[model samples]
Target: MSSVLITGASKGIGRAIAIELAGRGHRVIATARRPETLADLPVDQRLRLDVTDQESVDAAIREAGEIDVVVSNAGESVRAPLESVPLDEVARLFELNTLGALRVVQGVLPAMRERGSGRLVFVSSIQGRMVLPMIGPYGATKWALEALAETLAIETGHFGIQVSLVQPGAVSSGGGERAKVHLKDNDPYSALYQELPVLRGEVVTPEAVAATVADTIEQPEPPLRIPAGAPAKQVLEARKVAPEDKPFLAVPLNW
Candidate 1:
């Protein structure tokens, strides 16, 4: 069984994934920004890991020992029109959702490389494939993560490191839901936010996303991308049907 290290495993999808993997007999090292939050998790190890902090990540990596799989599941989202969203909020979102994932990846890659085998499962979103008006920043972060994970797939393939992006839509536990943040009350895009439908189809459970990730980790050679629920599958199809809706809807980018 692979020794799996998960970021943000204290609750929601990350928490569920840790439990599922541990139950399946993998040695699971569950981590969160606050180790205390991890006290209730049934896993092989619990450690403090703030993906946005290099020192915290380093400490966790060293403490966890040899890690065969790194699930970069720690992320936060902000809801707002791109124009009205505060720049500082955007920066913080990227710092955690984008750079935070990168920080963990960088911390673990050398060890995985030395061992010549590893798996990276990123808990991305269906929004990574398409954009909605109110979810610009959140989608941006996921899109960025998708790019980084894909690049790692290519760069690390020869070394036997597998990368899979598990894109789930509208997770049921409200994992990705965020309070709308605008710089002012008289925002121009208020109507747009009110009208746009962000959550479509059936909401996925944290366990469902966790199962998909567990599959990715356990597979001898998992696919480069996976949709964690029907909604996400629909999102991809929706994009294909309306390419003009997203002209540069090429194989790169995120929220």
Candidate 2:
């Protein structure tokens, strides 16, 4: 089995993946901003890794030693309208959800390049495919992440490095409470906030998402992008069937 490294593994999908992969006998190195949070996991190694900090990322990679697969799952969610969202908050979101993945990718890539084999799996969201009113900020991050992962797939193919984006729909991440809403009681976008949850599909467990990621890793030649749940697949299918000339606004809001 390959040596695997997962970020944001203290809880949620990352935590489930660590458990699943370890159960399958892969050497699992699970890391988070606080290594102490990972004490109960059955993985091979638990190290402190803050993806926002370059030094911390490098240190984790050094300690892990020759990782064969890197699952860049460290990310967060936010809810706000573009008109009222703070610029500083947007920047912080990008720093974690976007650049953080890049830092980890850059850190582990050299060894993979020299050894001529590795995999990079990024945990993206269905929002990357479609956008909701109050979720634009979060969608923006995943959309940008998809672009980077797609580009890396082309650029790193010859080096024997594979990149995949695992996009899951609504997850049971504490009833979506993980996403901090930036709006106030009398906010102008209150209507959107009230209606947002209605547009979501069935909520899947973290274990289901973990199963998809693990299945993707087992593929000798996995596809560049995978929609992990029924909700995720439905979103992608909707996008595919949409008319090219008509605006997204014109399309039915049946989703």
Candidate 3:
């Protein structure tokens, strides 16, 4: 069994992935900001790790020696227009979603390169490729992440390390429930905001996403990117054929 380390494993997709891998007999090391939250998880180890902090990442990596697989699943989302979203909040999102993943990669790559065998899995979103209303800030981070993951795959292939990106559509994770939507009463995008609910289609479950991640790990040669659900796959296909001026709508009725 391979030793796997997953960041942000206390809840949502991260938590589900940890559980799935552990059930598959892998030695899973789960990390979250609060280790207590991971106390009951069926993992080999639970460490306090705040991906936004470099020191925390370094300490966690040092403690968990020789990881065979690293799942960069720590990320956050902000729902707001690019014009109205606070710069500070956008910065915070980038810090956690983009830079945080980079930090973890840096912390784990040295050992992986030395061993000449490892796998890096990044949990990105479909928004990484196609942007929607009110999710621009969050989408921008994923876009950057996709670029980073793809480049990392190219750079690390020679070192016997594989990189994979799992992009999921509107998953039924607590992220939607906890999302911070910012909009003034007379916002110009009010109509679009009203239509937002209709834009969201069937939600994929976290367990399903977890299964995809596990499958990716088990593959001797996994694809560079895997869209986790029907919604994601359909939207991505639409993006390829849809004109630049005519954006594809997520709502099935509109499609």
Q: Give a tens-digit lDDT track for model 2, residues 89-163.
A: 888889999999999999988889999999999999887777767778788988999999999999999999999
Name the top lDDT candidate.
3
* lDDT: the better of candidates 1 and 3: 3
lDDT of 3: 0.90
Better of 1 and 2 by TM-score: 2
In candidate 3, stretches whose alpha carbon ends up further than 4 angstroms from where it belongs are: 245-248, 251-255
Which portions of model 1 miss their true places by more than 4 Å? 176-180, 196-199, 245-255
* Candidate-wise lDDT, in order: 0.84, 0.88, 0.90
The digit string of per-residue lDDT tens for model 1 on 110-147 reads 98898898888899988787765667898899999999
Give the lowest summed-lDDT range of ten residues in model 2: 246-255
Record all residue pairs in model 1 with backbone atoms less than 3 Å apart, i.e. clashing.
Answer: 138-255, 139-254, 139-255, 140-254, 140-255, 141-255, 142-255, 143-253, 143-254, 143-255
CA error at residue 166 for candidate 3, angstroms: 0.2
* Candidate 2 Cα misplacement greater than 4 A, ranges: 245-255
